[model samples]
Target: MDLLTARIDLDAIAHNTRVLKQRAGDARLMCVVKADAYNHGAQRVVPVMDASGADAFGVATLAEGASISELTAKPVAAWLWVPGQEIPPGVELGVPTLDHLSWLIDARVNAPLHIKVDTGMHRSGLRESDWEAAFRMAARAGLEVKGLMSHLAVADDPANPYTDAQADAFRRAVALARQVGLEVPVNHLANSPALLSRPDLAFDQVRAGVGLYGLEPIAGGGSDLRPAMSWVARVLAVKPLSVGEAVSYGLTWAAPDNGFVAVVTAGYADGVARSWQGCLDVAIGAHRYPQVGRVCMDQFIVWLGDNDAGVAIGDEAVIFGAGGVGATELADRVGTINYEIVCAPTGRTVRTYTGGTGA
Candidate 1:
């Protein structure tokens, strides 16, 4: 079997969820397991989340919501809706616009639904101009209005005033719903950053997205999160390169000194993005080594310096996770966010889960 794997610490996830819940105080925790729990494998994340007291699970699509609802008894809500996607039997849906409500009414969608308000983000939500029509139409159709939700544009930045403004607007929108005779039970506008920084925004529940997976949504928030996913592969071969010798593909990187190279059976095809070639480092146990040469589709070369490198075939090379190259560091080096780094590894790599209620 391929040695490349993404070992997940479900315990860390549970810990993070608990911490987030603690931060939220009285608000229920909505573990956003969308994008396959940001590619941490929702198949493994959902059950453990329930064990950790997650009030609900948030997914991005109807299919994802349906998949998880079949696995756990907790409520699963799909926030983004396309016109024809099948709304699963009990899965809550995020109703964004009058058109979405129209489709829900036409399809006879008889599940819990939250109204998305476009208070300030101008994203997918009911507009201020369309709120009355949406509320009235939904009421006319007897659609149960379970909650009122809005997406924040700058909740991640503590210095941004938009969070306050958005929260106020969200409240105003909810008040408008009340005026229209709709009882909006759950009022949620907080994502991870908002939950960690602005507890006032956590009305009924907070959608803890990347934060639950131990990747911080805010710059300093990672200090509280334990990285849940680790990427690793085993060394396939070790060899020495002469001072002037070039390395893999187009000779992009060459041996500056006499260095030993360990070829690991993991590369872009395995979710190690090609852009990581000249920039990323992998860990052998706790020792870090620079990756040389252009990363291949199936393998990459790590330059272990001199004889002290002491690496051999069959040794594990950790790409990122505990005691290894962390996802946050890799994200900074790659000029992207940690969300992509953790979600990078696909199912092509083996997933070994550890540390949780299941443990």
Candidate 2:
């Protein structure tokens, strides 16, 4: 039996995909499976998402795009790539810079691509000053310009005016691209937060990333999305601790009273951030226990106050998930985000799937 495991509910993924698809309305739904579906095992979840309602798939790298390209016949587009990388066959590309567009033209690469315009994100994308020039260049090279794409600078906050500003800028880019003789037909700019909040910004397609995995990007937006991942560890041992006795490395914490502590089989090496020590509340059976002391390389201690729930050595301890604290709650406690929470369970952690029928 694996000591640490990430229980992935495939049904939750399907439900989230369908919900996003419905939210997209007339627009297409592009499921972002980059970072291995945000470290949720894209190989397993991509098929579920495609079977549910994914119109396309997006990834950060060509390799990532290539990896999941065969999972679904739907088009896979990768946005983050260097100039010299070999373009994988059957995967679409997102031209982020004028230099990348020029490289593709010079190399005579014949692949469908989306022009990533810098719509105020100012991260990676062709600048507005070069939009017409780049569009003309792509048109002259006879490059198949699939559409335009942009990233939102601040869409998580519905109250943030930057999202609307970015939307307007993206719209202008599309118009300029068309004016410069590039069709730029299927343009998109909205991410998870924007897709959840602003349907008007969905343009031709909404790239649903975290929401596909059931994470509510907008704080307290309260969608019916179900969280899909659960990080769990096995209880290794239960030891009694005296009031003044300390535990683990640095001896940072001591038993407040004469109670028992359960040693859980997960630690920093397993993606449990050392900084998360003292902020985690592990759930075992029906009771919650406080994670005390310093986190170790392979394990940590959870104070099971009198062992009230009878947590045994082999009992399952939920670090975060359906039964324990939600990923968002744990993120708030650890000063991180739900995305990182789901991506945590690594080193020696086994993954298992459940409920994929979307029932």
Candidate 3:
């Protein structure tokens, strides 16, 4: 058995895709599979999404787009790339700036392009001042302008007014693109959070990212989405700790009494962040144990508290997943988001898939 594993449920992915597609209504569902499907392994999840209801795929880099272009016949659009990078064939491009547009035009890139406008995020995409100019330039260059796309800054908070402001800006960009002779068909602006909360902003397509992974983007918003990934480790060893005796580096935590502690296989190097020390609760069978002391590079100690459940070596210890704390709850404990929690399993963490056959 693998010492550490990120168990991915492909059926959950398919279920989430179908749910998002149904929620999208008339708008097309563009499943965002960037960062290897948020570290869920795009190579596998993409097919599940495609088989379910994903109308298209979206990635952050050209390489990522190219990697999964053949996975589905649906359009694959990559939005994050530098100007001089070689554009991959068979993949759509999101033009984030005038310079990127100019580069594409100069190179005569034949890929379908989505003009990324800065509605509110202000991280990437073309500024409002350059929208008209860029639109006209693409029109003049006879580029295949697929549509307009933008990012929502505060879509996670449904009550945030900035989402409304950004939606208005996105509408203006789409209108201006059409005014400048670009058909601007299939424009999209709503991300997972917006797509879940604001159907009004789902203009032409909805890019569902984290939601496709069964994570609710809105805080305190419960949905039918089931989490797909589980970070689990094996109990390497269980030993007794005397009172006043400590465990792990710095001996930051000691046994509250004469209780037992279990050595878990996961550590910081296995994507269990060092900062997660003292905050994580590992679940073994029916019992929950508090992780104590400094997190090591290859292992950590979880106080089993008298080994009531008799957690033994090789027993599966769920760091976060179905039997343990949920990703959202773990994120709340670690001062992060569920997105990062799902994406954290790396290094020695091996990925194992389950429920992919549609059973």
**How are the candidates ranked when ordered by lDDT, highest leading?**
2, 3, 1
Error of 1 at 10 (Å): 1.4
lDDT tens per residue, model 1, 14-66? 88888888898898888898888888888888888788778988888888999
Which pairs, if any, clash in model 1? Answer: 11-355
* lDDT score for residue 196 of model 2: 85
Candidate 2, residue 251: CA error in Å?
0.8
lDDT of each: 0.85, 0.91, 0.91
Candidate 2 lowest-lDDT run of ten: 350-359
On the 0 to 100 scale, the lDDT of residue 138 in model 3 is 92
**Candidate 3 lDDT by residue in tens digits, 168-245:** 898898889899899988999999988888999999999999999988899886778999999999999999889999
The clash count of every prediction, one per candidate, is 1, 0, 0
* TM-scores for candidates 1 onward, in order: 0.96, 0.98, 0.98
Regions more than 4 Å wrong, model 2: 357-359
lDDT of 3 at 205: 97
lDDT of 2 by residue, 1-359 (tens): 88999999999999999999999999999999999899889989998998999999999999998899988899999999999999999999999888998899889888999999999988999889999899999888889999999999889999999888888898899988899888877999999999889989999999999998888898995889999999999999998989989999888998889989999999999999999988999999998889999999999999988887788989999999978999999999999888888888899999999988532
How accurate locally is residue 90 in candidate 1, as Cα lDDT from 0 to 100? 82
Candidate 1 local lDDT, residue 65? 90
Task: Output the TM-score of candidate 2.
Answer: 0.98
239: Cα error in model 3, Å: 0.9
Residue 237's lDDT in candidate 3: 90
